[model samples]
Target: MNRNIFIANRLREVLLNGHWIANTNYKEQLSDISWQQAIQQINELNTIAALTYHINYYLRGLLTAFETGKLEISDKYSFDLPEITCKDDWDKLIQDFVKNAACFIEKIEQLDVEVFEKPFFDEKYGSYLRNIEGVIEHSYYHLGQIVLIKELIAQ
Candidate 1:
């Protein structure tokens, strides 16, 4: 397959439906938890809700850049998750997360295959391929955390 489709598939593998790598994707994990479960704090680690917001933050930022050619997201603000005080709040965050992940994947699949080799917003960030892979890797990193946190919360 072409690189764009291949990259989009990898993005979906981690964020959406594919289960080859983690045996669980974000949608599956986040969907199974309750709002109270998501916001529960466990020691020094981040809450599941916080991690979810953090990952969605980057996905939304990257989607913006894909649509407008402007990368305005700052790492400093990525973790600024508003209070998810109720089921409605958590549900809204999950809804937005799923929508943004779909949009991010659609943006990737629409890219010209050649754009993968181009710098992503800036040369300092390396190629588009690099950043896309970073998202997959980063998502897995937090997915693992979320899984373990869920397990602990159950204990």
Candidate 2:
């Protein structure tokens, strides 16, 4: 298998299905959470819905980059999570998250391996390979936070 394909598969595993480290991926972690629980704010920590939106925001940006060779996302606006007032809203968010992630994986799979060797956008941002790996790493970091927040909410 191509190395890029392998990495993309790993991305899918971490984002959509089971992963070795956490034994649970984003979707699995969110599977049982209710809308009320998703929007519940514990202390000052971000809600589950917020984190879900945040994850998809970056993923969507990266997907755009891969498809159009340009990225338009900024960190300042990444966490501007939409309000989730009911179960349908939460469900739509989750559905969009899953759809975006799958699209990202597909784009990665279609990428020429040489693209990974090139700079992502600018020299300071590093190579496409680095950014792709960073995205996966970032997801795991937030996944851990989401797990902890869920536990705290449960207690």
Candidate 3:
């Protein structure tokens, strides 16, 4: 298998399915959570809904970069999560997350291995390889937080 394709597949697995690390991916962890649970605050830490939005927001930014060849996201606005007042709102957010994740995987698969070696948008930002790996790492980092928060909420 192509290395790029392999990486893309791994990204999909980590984001949407069981991965080697925790045997639980973002989708699995978020699957059984209710809207109330998602918005529950534990010790003033971020709610599951907010974390989910933050994760997908970065992914959406990366997807935009891949599609438009421009990195237009800023950290200032990254955590601006929407108000989840109802089940439908939370459900729509999850749906959007899944769709954006699929789009990200598709974009990664379509890129050539050579592109991975090239700078991602700018020289300071590093190569596509680095950014892509960073995305995986970032997701896993938040996945851990989400899992912990869910556990805490359950108690």
Identify the leading candidate in terms of TM-score.
1
**Model 3, span 1-155: residue lDDT tens:** 98789888888877987579877899988889999999999987989999999989998998887779889999888889989999999999899998899888888899898988999899999988998999888888889999999999988
Residue-level lDDT of model 2, residues 51-151, one tens digit each, is 99999999988888767877789998888988889999999999999999999988888889998989988888999899999999999999999999999
Comparing 1 with 2 on TM-score, the higher-scoring candidate is 1
Error of 3 at 60 (Å): 1.1
**Local accuracy by lDDT, each model:** 0.94, 0.90, 0.89
Misplaced by over 4 Å in model 3 are none
Q: How large an RMSD does model 3 have? A: 0.9
Across residues 1-155, which tens digit of lDDT does each residue of candidate 1 receive?
99999999998998899899999999999998999999999999999999999999999998888779899999999999999999999999999999999999998999999999999899999999999999989999999999999999999
Candidate 2 regions exceeding 4 Å error are none
Per model, state how many residue pairs clash: 0, 0, 0
In angstroms, give how far residue 121 of model 2 lies from its true place.
Answer: 2.5
lDDT score, residue 27, model 2? Answer: 89
TM-score on alpha carbons, each prediction: 0.98, 0.95, 0.96
Positional deviation of 151 in candidate 2, in angstroms?
A: 1.0
